[model samples]
Structures are given as C-alpha cells and as structure tokens.
Target: MRARSHSPRKPKPNSVMGSPKMKSKSKSPQKKHRAVINQLDYLNSQCHMEGCSVSIVVHSTRFLICRHQLCHASDYFKDLLQSKYGSEDFYVTVSSMSEPTPSTQFRWFVESSIPCPALKDISDETLETCMRLSRRFDAKGLEMRCTKFIVENACSRQPIVALCWLNWALKHKFDAQTQASCLPSVARLSLTALEQHRHMLTEKIFSDLLAAKLRGTYDKAVQVFRAIHRMDHFSVEVDRCPRCGRTRDGMRVKVNADPCRKQIGCDRCHRESCEIENKAGDDLQAFYQCPHGLVPLNSTTDECHCQIPNLAHHLGSRYYFRSENGTILNPPPLSPHTSRTFDPAEDTSERPGTSYKRQTSRDMDRREQRQSAVVVRLEMLVVSLQPEESVRRAEIVSFGSSVILSIAFFYIFTMLNAFTTTNIALLDKSSGCFEKKISKYYGQPKKLWERFSRAVSLCSPRLHSVELGAFANTDEFKVPLLAPSEDCVVLSLGIGKDVKAERRMRDRMSQCVFIGADPVNESNADLFSQVGKFYNVAVGHKNGSFRSYVLEDVYRYQEVAYMDLATFIKLNVNRKIVDQMMMDVEHAEYPVLPFLEKGGELSQRDIAINIEIHRPTSEDLQAFVGFLRRNSLSQQWIFINSEIHPFFKHIRLFMINGQNKECRRRFWEN
Candidate 1:
C-alpha cells in the first residue's frame, strides 16, 4: 500500500468554482429579481422602484414594478411572472387589475404588503371582495384578519351574513377553518330559522344542511333508544325477564268480597245499623285523608280487573312473526305500561309550541326500536368502558362484528343451497349413484366404528327432523318413483367446466330433451357446447341478472352472470313437466327452492331436482330437507366424497310430489 496525500484537487480554468466541494454563487435573473423584490416597499409611488421591467396595469393606470416585487406575494404570481416572458429585457404585463370586480380587490391586496388600514370601515361588499382577493392570492394573514373581523362583527350581529360568508367559502372551497367555524352554529339553527333563511342556502350549504339533519335524526333516534331502555317498561316488545323467556299474563284474578251481612234480614243487624246511624249524628271527628286520593270502589265484577303485564315483561318471547306478505307483524298491546298514560290532550295543551310530529310519546315512531339491545347501545358501551379497555373493546367489537357477518353470510349461503342440493349420506351401492338418499342412522353407532359413528351422529338429518317433522322423510331416498326415459324433460343449471353429469344424463336418456345453463362465457364455451341447446345464463329463483361469486383455487373471487330459472324454463322448455332439473348454481339454491315452493310451481310439474350444494352444515341440510318434505316432496341426498374437495362438499337432492310413509325407516331395539 502507498501513502496518499490529503490535499484537495486543483480547479480548472473553465470552472468558476475551485472544486465540486467549493460553494459558488450562480446568479440567474430570477435570483437577482428575487433579491431586489425581497426589499420592503416603503414608498407608494412607482418611481421608487427603479430599474423595474414589469408594469402592473390596474384599470388603465400603469405602475412600473420590479419583476421580483410582483412575484413576492405568492408562488402563483412568481410562477406566472417568470413563465409569462422568459426574456429579462421585455416588460411583463399583470392583467388581474384590469377586471372591474377584482380591480379594487387587487389594489387592496397589493397595498396589504405594507401594514395599513385599507380594509377598515369598509362596506360588507368591499370586505367580501377583499376577502375573495386574499383567498385567490392565498394571503393567509389577510384572509385570517378578514375572517376574524367578519366572524366577530358581521357574523355575530347578523347570522344570515355568517351563512352568506359560509356559503361563499364553501362555493369557492376557501379556508377550512372559516367554513368549519360556521358549521356548528349553522347546524344548531332551528327549523324556523332555516326556513326564514332558506334562500341564503346554496347547493353546497343545502347538502351540508341535509347531512346535518340526517346526523341529528340519527342522534335523536339513539337518544330515544337510550331513554326508552331506562324506563321501567317500553312500548317495544323487548321488556322480558333476562333469566327466563316467559311473560306474566297481564290480567290477575280478583276474589269476590264476602256476601254483605247487612243483606240478611236479622233484627240484630237492623238494631246495629240504627245504633251506628245514631252514633254518627252524635260524634264528628276529623279523619286522615289518603295521599293518593280516594279511589272509586268497583261495584261490578267486570270493573274489578287487575293490571296486565307489559310486553317488556317477555324478554325472550318471539313476538315478531312474518306474515304471508313477508311483513314482520309484532302486535303488542296498544297501551304501554308507563307510570303515566299518554294523554294526548294534556300533552298537546302543555307543549303548545311543539308540533304533533315532534311528540316523542307517539308509539308509531318507536316501533323500529324493538329488540335494539341485548344489553345497551354501542355509545353507552363505549362510555362505560375504561380507557385501557376501550382499545380491547374496539378490537373485540371489530373481530366480533367480522365473525357475526361471516356467520350470517354462511347461514345465508346455506339457506340458498337448501332446495338445490341432494343428500346421499345413506345411499349405498345398491342405490343408483344418481339417486338421492337420506341417512338411516336411527341406531347409536359403536365407538369402534368411527366413520359410521361420526356419520350417524353428525351427518344424520334426524337431529333437526324433530323440529320439522312434517317435512322430514319417513324413509331414505326409497320412494317408489320410476326412472325417467323418453318422456322426461331434463334441465340442469350451472353445469361445471367438466359437464360430466349433463353428458351422462343425456347419453342415458337418449329420447329425453336436455337443456343446460352456465354463464362462464369464455372458458367453458367448449364444455357447454357439448350439451344439447345450452344457454349462457345462470339460474336463480327470479328473472334478473344476478352476480355469481366464484371462489377460485387461487384464493380470489370471480363474478359471473346469473339468470332467473323460471323465466329460462318458460322460454326454453316446451314440455309442461320437467322430469328432473339438476341445479348447481352454487349458493343460489336458497332463493330458487323457496321461489318454487312459494309459488306452488313445484306442484305444477313432476320435477326431480338433483342440485349440488356448496358447504352446507347438518343444520342447513336438515332445514333444506324439511323444506322439501313441507312441500309434500320426497327428498334424498347424496353426500360429496371428502376426497374430491378438502373443505367444500356438494349434495345431490331429489324431490318428488308424493310421500312414502310405509317405507319409513325406524330403529327397533335389537
């Protein structure tokens, strides 16, 4: 290694700087102009700014100025002046002063550089013009002073002026502080004030007003819920015992008073009555009065009724019921168990100024508030929580909400697959592969038989059968229905990319008419082309374009087109009766099946549905099976082998019009 000298390199003659490390002053025209403009303008006359290239013309009056002074107020002016004329020899013209509306504003803004009272004691119109100019130039000091003065004097004295200013600021998208300062007071404006000054509101202010009104309505609703919850009883049907689901009967039995002894025609009673009457005349003593006032005694048995229990007394009762029209009907008692009855006359007389719409005592408005809480509202919950626990609570709420949403989605998905999917859990080799079968696991399984035991316990639909006995199959997929041949019209919705099932059915039933529907336009065109008269549409319960979400192996969701099944069938199928329709429209089976059942469309034809279910639990399957049974349709299921898909499984459900009660499979103690 050689020793190195620690000396700097020598500068070249061409380079003004000694080295790259050495600092040099490279004076561009912009720097020279900026240096001159940096000096404070003390004199009002243009003669003071000597050697100026730019001439600022305000309303035909020309004021010669250095280019740097014109650019000093804002970067916008600086960029404008520099970019307008690149040459330093030519005079650049400033034209903002030429406009009639902005001429005075421009003069004031230009003069504001030196501390002066140019803005003092001006008309609101002039001040507004000055403020606009300040905003245009982004002069923060002028804008702040204008805002402070206007808000303190003009806005404070006349709120309409405040609204006007706010409206202006919002229209031009001015300083947020100015706009925000006006919002709270504007929001607090009474309806009377709003109506009176309604003309002052621009589109932007109107939108803000609408948003504020919505927020206020929401806040009021929350407050009402909190208030009602605190009361001993609410008109809502949520007032039930936390521990038990039962409600006490409103009416209590009253014991009849003992038959009056005075009615007896005895001489002793007459003598006692005469003596009591005579003693009343002689002795008159003061008696204490009841604090509650004298209550009128009920003479008749009918009038001696006891108070009834309020709906709140029934916490866990299923008061809500869906009608045939799909509306939820909660027929709670008309009168709520308030300590004070809602005397409309008295309420109106006392609160004379309050309109009927503003009355909180009305029960109609409170109907939606039923079952709004398990404990309390989220606002209350947050307030009651500790600061440290708040974070934990938020995390819990977020996680819990996500979980609930996931569960709800899963449930909806399950219900959707209810009608379309088939059961084959108990289908043996003897039962044709296409036939749906129900689990015949009435007997308890031995622990040694793990798979069978698990299948018997978990896979069996009987657990839910008791709840819906009317719909449960008396037997497995053992209904005595002959297999379809030439007379059959088969419609299969959502044939997979393979089209294995559709091809097999078409091949087996050569004389039958086959129609298949799928909406994978690009990739599955070839597969769908293989089937007879396949349509590029999805089958849902109704007639519309539905978005089908497909979860791919790559962990991404792809959406496809979905069409209504009824409309497709009506358009495509010539035969009145569809012998078998295999539906594999993912979770779409939920709405489709219900639609069929609800409209009695299932009964119109002898259709056997062999649909593939997507991820249905035992409960879901049971509900589905029950739905089939309720429709007087015999249902069978074919379970998807777990080997094919690790997580997702399919079911092939079969439905027929008649029942086979005699074929009911039962467990006899062996």
Candidate 2:
C-alpha cells in the first residue's frame, strides 16, 4: 500500500514511533542496504511492535502490525483478512481525532502484553477512544474492559455524569451488570432532573426508577408513623394563670367555673365571680354543697379529712405518674411514722367533742370525695388527649387503606381493560344459534332452497370483535386481539402474493413465529419468507398429491404435494399447540374442515382459526356452521366477500376454540 506524502518536519520529542531521521556516511550500496535492514529489525522488536508482516497506514504515519494478532483480537479484522479477496497490503485509517489519536490506541491495544491495560494511567479521552474502536472492531475483550470500568466508576461521579454514562451504555446494549450499576444514579436523581432527561431512558427503566422512588417514600412515611407512635405516650401539663386561677395550654383553655366553655371571662373579678357562681360544673364543689349530706368537709378550712390518707394510699400503690422519658415520677415511699391510717376510728383528725356517728359519716364522705376528685382529674387528662390520638390513628389507617385500595383497583382495572381491549365474545347459549326462537326452526330445512336461506340467516352468537390487518384490499382480516405470548406459533396455510395480514400480526406481536405453506413456489416463497418459514407443499385433509388452483385464476391449476393438518403441526410445533392458524387455499377449505373435525384437532388444544371460505354452496355453508358448533368454536368475526360471486360468496370467518380448557383459562377466565 502507498503511504500518503507529508512535508518533512522534525519529530515530536515524545513520539512513540521515535525519530524518523537516520544518516550513514558509508559509500558502498551493500553497507547502506545492511544498515536499512538493521533499522527495520529494530522497529520490529520495539515495545509497541506486534509484528512487521503487514503495514497499517494512518494518514502520514505507518505502523507494522501482525495479521494473526489483529485477527485474534478483533472479529472485524478476522473476517476482513480471511476473505477470498483480502490482500496483505490493506491499510486501516483512523479518521477521528483524539488526545493520543486512534492509531496510538490501536497499537497499544494490540501490542500490550496483558489482556487489559492499566486503565488508571490512561486519560478519559483516550479511554473513550478505546471504547469506540473496540465497539467498531467487535473486540469482545476490549468491550468487556470498557464496560467494567464504567460499572465500577461511573456511579461514583456526579449524578449527571453517571446518567450520561448510563445512557451511553444502554444505547450500546451493554451487559446487564453495567446497566444495573448505573440504575442507582437514576434513583439518586431528583424528580426534575429525571423529567428533564426522561427522553434519554427507555420506558421500562423509567418506570422501575419511579417505583423505587415511591417505595422509598412509603418507607419513610412508615418510619415517621412509628416514631409518632412511640412518642405518643408523653403527658402534657397545663399551667394555671396566677391571678385568674384559670388553666391555659396551647390553643386550649380550661376554666375552674365552666370546664367545657369555649369563651373566657371579661376580667379577673368576673372570672372569680363566675367560679363562685357556677357550682354545677365543679364536681368537687357540688359534692361539698350536697344538701343530703352525702359528703362532709371541715367547716374551718373546707379541706377533706381523708385527703392525706388518699394521697398516701395512691403514692404507696401502683398508681404512679410517668414523665416524658418514661421514668416513674411517684413520690418517695411513706415512712411508718408518717403513714396515714385507712380506718376512720384511728384517724388523728377526729375532734374530741364530735359524736361517734357524726365522725364516722364525715370521714366516709371526705374519703369518697377525695377519691372521686383524683379519678375525675385523671379522666379529664385522658379525655383531653383522646381526640388527637384518634386523629393520628385515623390518618395511618386511612393511608394504609388507600394504598390497599389503590393496588386492588389497579389490578381490577388492568384485568377489565385487558378483556375489553381483546374484544372477547362469550357464547350466549340461551339465545340459540339464530336471533329468532329455536322452535321456529326446530328441525333442519327439508328443501334445498329453504336450507340455503336458513344457512344464510344463521347468526353465530358473538359478543364483540376487533378487525386487524391492512385496510386496502382483500388482504384485510379480522381476529380478536388476544393477549400476546412469547412462544406463540402461527400457521399460515396459504400465501399467494400478499402477506399484509401476516406482516401486521408480526408487527403487533413480534414474538410469534410464523410457518407459511403454499403450493406455488413463485413470489409466494419470497414474500412469506420475510415473516417466517415458507413451505412449497399445500395443506389438505390427507398427505397426498392434490390439485391446487391459483386464487386469481380458478381455471389455472397444478398438482402439488399436500400434508395433513396434524402432521404439519407435529412437524413444526413441539408442544402441539398452535396459537393462530390462517388459511386461504382458494376453495380447498370445504374438504379441510371435515378433516379437522374428524381428527379432533380443535378439541385437543386452543387454536384460533382465521379461514377464508371460497364459493360455498348451501350444503357447504350448513356443514361449515355445523362443524363450528360441534367443535365448540365461537365465531369472533365474519366478512362476506361477494365481489367474485354474489350467489356463492367467499365468507371469511375467525373463530376461537371455546371448549379447550387452556383456551378458556388464558382468554376468558382472566
């Protein structure tokens, strides 16, 4: 290969190719030739040298590289050099400009002793150049190294930078590890950032990221609720106004006069008067003023005679107040000397002049009043905080209920939407085959004319249908849009010149595998081959030679090899289940329908049939409807193509095997 000419210039100080200038004073041609050979030998044995067998010229620079080394390292090089017309003098040019240039990176990659070079020493630009070259050359080793570097280091960078790397990896179809490692960066991204870069991500990745975010938010909310539940047991104390003697707490006021009243008194004297005037609201005061003498108090101080005993009893027992830190705030245990007596007769507060009966009544009333007052205060505190606790609990319950309902509604909507979109039609057995009463046509029509009219009027019970295929010509067909399956197999019984319907089905469901058959081996083979496997034989009742006619011209016919439906299915499908079968064999469906019914193929598995019945007579029509009814196949869609013959119409029908258990489970039970 010829190297491009360049102006003579001094070599850079750090050039890997070294100085290109050499001088020799020897006059003899033999000595100069020997010196040139020595120079080439030195270049071949250098650190960057792979071999001196082939020259790779990149612009003005040329490098000697080995063919075997390049071929082993890259698929592109292997295929190029192993081809019939490949020459040893071919040149590889690197057009893109980089810091070290593509030529330098290529030389380093091929000549390095290790499979992967030390990436830490290489600059980012040089690494990027290596990745580009590796992908371009289909170098698996280099691609793996690049992918490893990205997976290990990309997420450690800024989120935006990591997202850029992730987008690049996804676009290039990197390994799953690389994609997984980059997904964390997506989770770290803010909502606004994700929205801004949403166009860069695939739909599945975007949804996964959103789901992760929602899960995290829900977890945080749960943590908050747990903290609230733990801290809910703390008690709140209300401070009293020194002058008015009214209690005040945050956003709430409790007056001694009217505990349930919302409004406050106008002045301190008014509050005092209100407190003295409203005896009904104060249970303690009402107990004191009871005219029936149910409770009695000391006339001097108006204090309960059993107050000390009640306080001592409460403190010594299990009834203890707890602080915010859950520590017990009960007073010190009562000493034997200071402990009050529970019996009224042993009390020290009894007067010497008091009668025994009066003293007993006064002590009992005072003890009861003190106990009631203590109970009332505790109850008031509990009632005050009950509403807040109820509201918080309600909030948590509401949140949980909403989440459960949302999930249930989503599943219900998804199921309903799937059924609705499929356009499924369930059989109405009570309605009978025709719209009229079954008694009206109880027996089969005796006359041929009556039978023909009855067959024409026959209406298969269909709930709904969806049309699919090209709208232009007779290539258009209708079938229920069933759920997609990954391992779906479709059998195409005939292929004339058009495969529009098959192509549309493939577009809708790319996972479906199509096996097409046709008698003529003309353009039909090429057209059907684009979508799936095409067979040159025809499909019929039995495996034998059959006469087939062209759809365009019924008179033109040819003898073709034919295979039975069971044999075709067994040969192509391992599971013996055909998801869909499309047949348009001129007028051969009349004989094929009987074979399918007698063989019990429709009963064994779920198979959706889309057949174009060509030129059927009254008897043929009646037999066709009878076959469908016997096989438990419900018609989903029917089209009459009367363009060819008005009297003997070509009826196109799509039916599903409703009797099959698997069919009902997959299409109806959902």
Candidate 3:
C-alpha cells in the first residue's frame, strides 16, 4: 500500500529569463529622473524581507527581498544566498524553484509576515501547491494552515482528495490531528475502491480498513445465523449419516482404504478387518467434506465454513444462511472459493473422458447387499471395544475438569484474602517506622504458666475492683489508661451533633489545647471555636474525598474532605505526643488502629483513646478488640464499656503504657 516518492528538482541558472530594458521615450530630463525614482520606490514598498540589499529573480520575475527573511525560511536558502551574494550587489537572479514559476508562491511567502494569509479563499489545489512550496522552504506556519484547510474542508467534500492528502501526510509525518481526520474517511472506502487505490494507502491504514470490513462481514453473518436459529424450532438436532446410521461424533475419517474390497472387510478373514476400518474412516471423511456437516451450538458460521451444493435440501435452513437476497450488511463475496464451471459433458453419466458412468438402480442394490453383509459381520467385532473407549474418554475428561475447578477455586480464595486485608504500613526493621505490610496481629502470645497464675489470683479483692481492659475475653495482654492533666494534648475526631463530652473535657483540662474535628459539624462550628482549632473535614480509613450521605433527604448526598488519623496527626501535630484522643466516626475505626500502633505521633505519651463502635456485629467487635490488644506499641488498655447497647458498644477509656523504663532495660540487655 506504500507509494513511491520523487525528490524536489534543483533550480537551473538558465531557467530564469533576462529582464527586459525600459526604453526612454520621454524627451524631458525631469520625466526620466521621476521614472527612475518611482521604480526604486516600488521595489522598496514590495520587499518586506530584512537587510534588503538585493533583488531575487526567479523564472524571469524579480522580487526585491531581504537576506535574513530568506535565511529564516530555510537553511538551504540562507547558506546559498549568504555565500553567493554580497552587501554591495543590489540584484541577483535565481533559477526555477518550481514549475511554471515560483514568483507567485515566493511573493506570498515573503509578504505573509505583513498580514495573515486568508486560506479559505484559495482552491484546494492552490492550497496544496502552496503547501508543497512551504514544505520545500520549511515555512512551518504556511504549511500548517494549508494542511488545516485540506483536512477541514477538502477531505470532507471529496474522498479522493482525502486519499491523496493521506499519502502526503504519511510521507511528511504531519501532525497527529490531521492524520486522525484522514483515518475514518479512508476506513469507509468500498472494497473495490480500496483495491484500486491500494498503492496510495499505507500498509497500516489498508490493514485497519480491511480488518474493519472483515469484522463487519462477520457480524452480519452472525446476525443472520442468530435470526435463522431463533426462527427455526428444531435446529438443535444431532446430524446422522443415512447410509451408516452413525452420528458425527461417533464416526471418524478413514486414512487408508482398499479399493478392491467391494465388501466391508479385506480379502483375508472377512471379520472386522483393515478394509472395514477403512470403510468407516472413508465414510467419516465424506461426511466431514460435506458443506452441511454438523456444528456445535456455541460455534459461528465462520468456524463452520459450510459450502456444499444442495445444502438446503440436505440440512434445510439450519445449516446455512442465504445472504445475497437477505438484509444482511456487506455480505461476503460470491462463491467463497471459486465458482465451479458447469460442463454438460462432465455432468452427463454417459461421458467416457476420465470417470465411469453413474450406476443404475439395479447396480446400486447389488452393492448395497454386499455392504450390508460386511457391516453385519464387522458390527460384532467393533461393538466389543466401544464400552472401553468410552470409559477411557470419561476418565480423561473428569481429570481435566477437576484440574480446571481446582485452579479456579485457588484464584478465588487468593482474591478474597487480598480484598479482606487492611491497608496499613508496617514498622521497618532499620527505621523503627511503620512502612511495610498491613498490621494483622503484631505481638507474640503470653506463657501458659503466667496465664494460669493470673487466673488463680482472681479471688483477690483488687482483681475484682480493677477495670477490665479492651479485649479482656481474648488472650491479648492489657495496659491501664492514665488520666490526662492540664498540659496534655488532645485530638477529638468525628464529634457528633452534641459537644457536651468535648465541652466537659475542655472545662476540666483548661490548660490543654484540643483540636476538635467533625465532618457534619458545620452548624456547631461556633461551639468548637472556644475549645481550640476546629475543622469540618471528616477522618476516615485513608486520605481522600469520600461520599458522605446526608440522611435529612433535603440536601441528598455530598462529598467531603477525609484524612486518616496518622496523616492528620502528622500534618497538624507533627512530632507532638497526643495525651488523649476521642473518635466517634460511624464505623470508620477499623482501618485506623494499625496507624495508631506504629505511627510516631503518639509513641511518647499514655494516649487515652475513647471510641464509639456503631452497629457492631459479634465478629467485628471481637476483631476490633483483638487488634487493639495485639498492638506492641500500645501494650495497655484502661476500660472497654458494653453498658450502652449490646450491638453498639464503646471503648470508653483505653490507653497505652507511657512509661518506657522496661522497654529501655530490655533494649540495653539485648
């Protein structure tokens, strides 16, 4: 589909015609001086090129121009003109740069800087001519305008023009927008037109067109197939051979046959011999060669490739679709392979050229009798091996099905595991920072003897009086909460409609600075103003804009800014150790537990975390408590309250162990 190209012709010195002399008919000396002065003025007015000390003559017409303008347009022109011409010389003649003349295009190119060229007024051919000149001179702006005019106007009106432009664009590597405009028009060309202009198109363009056409043809065929199948009620029947009474799947093609055996078996033993096997194989082959051969339900017309004569009589409309007289779009070519030339001599049974005449009814009956006798003899021997073959096939199928199911189940299990895992960063061994895999259960279990001893001491009055830690039912170790003082740092997340709890904490610890945050607390902004800094942004599992559904029905759903606890703490608190933090976000606490465990923001303080668990199921509550208990950084919890409601519980006063004396001792010993 690629086209051949020719290089631009170089200008010849003799191509430029010599300028004619103006005869002086005026008798007065004043008139002659005025004429010379007028000619000089005309030259200066027409030439706009900078550093104009010369006139360039092309194809007999002379254009007075500047040296810099010519150089700016092309490196070839700059090198040629600057190397040959001098400042003293005022005139220079150049040969033919274009056919007929380059004067018209050259004038436009030099004068284009004075005013923007109106490309709409020019004919497409004229525009193309200018484009070629611009291409040669490397005039980028002129070429772009010319290309735009061709694509926007000419290509839409005339397809042939588009075809020509496509070739030009490909060769020159035109801008992407112009090429995109050419592709769709070229793709819609008819097959005949495509063939005619194949050489003008690039291989990629031609292939894309062909592929689109092929897909259209295939889609139409499928439509016809579906229509026929839907209209016919009994199209799903299995196909059977009339002569052998065998279905397609039960029979196979024969590779080797003995022509001499009019009977089913070979000359030796007449039982299920090589000759009978060959007969079965041959019958299978003949069925396969027929165009009306059976196809599976899940297959398409292309996969079947049926082309048998009298297919309508043999298999009815179920086997094929008649598309020429049909409404199907872009039907395939006639005679899929090649039309068979009909010859009366070849058709006649009496012909003696290369084949025998057709058998009479009497001859057919005799052959049938011999075939029946051989089939009866072979049936006994073949029937014995049928059961064994079927059993072997079943075993193979079962094994393959089992393997497929196993692989499918494994893939599903892996995907479920990945989806359920929480998004959290782990502490790196070198940095002691949370920056790896999501935290699951962080610390190791306690000894059996220690658990037994603690259980035996349950009779003590202090043990009964002490508050239970969060996840007390689980095996995780506990830490008690420490009361906050006046100089403590507090971070309040998800403040509900009421600010009574927050106000009470603020009044008790007046010296502490509290940062209160709530997504839906814009109406109560005035209340939190006196407490500390208040933000309307919601805190969630991650930093993103999450959809916050308003239950009031008037405003509907809206999106709000959400930042995770770790990020909010990092961005606002930086390296400060939070003394107490309270969270009441509806079911948004699960994803933030690991962040509090490993993040450096609260590692130096006994942070009391008070959070309300909304609509908590048994499994969810257990998992939440277990996560808090297993955290290595937060080794203690004060109290977990279940007095509010069985389903909606709260961890009222949970805290981490702030004292690191034991930790330092262990580190030094290690």
lDDT of 1 by residue, 1-670 (tens): 9899989887776666734444457654332221222122323355344544455544434434456655665555676676665324332233344444333555555665323223254346656665666667556656666677655654354556667777777655665666766765676676557645655555456567756775576456545543443352212233333223334477322211112222322222233433222222112111223443433222111211121123323322224443344444454444332222223333433444656545654564354345444223553565467877977898988999999999999999987666343222232321332222222321212221223223323333321121211111111121112233346676767655645545545555667777777766554566557657778776786665555754233222455565666667778886677766666676777666665563455545544455555555455555455453444233322222111122233443443322222112211010
Candidate 2, 151-226: lDDT as tens digits: 7787677888778777877777777677778788768888667856876777678778877885576556545544
| TM-score between model 1 and native | 0.26
Question: Which of the predicted structures, 1 or 3, would earn the higher TM-score when compared with the native?
Answer: 3
Per-residue CA lDDT of candidate 3, range 350-440, in tens? 4454343244544655676577657645543443446659876678679989999999999999877754532111111211221111132
Best by TM-score: 2
Return the clash pairs for model 3, or none: 253-281, 254-281, 426-435, 426-436, 479-636, 479-637
| Prediction RMSDs, each to the true structure | 33.2, 35.5, 30.2
lDDT of all predictions: 0.48, 0.58, 0.49
Of candidate 1, the 10-residue stretch with the lowest lDDT total is 466-475
Candidate 3 residue 482 C-alpha distance from true site, Å: 49
TM-score on alpha carbons, each prediction: 0.26, 0.32, 0.31
The better-scoring model by lDDT among 1 and 3 is 3
**Model 3 clash tally, residue pairs:** 6
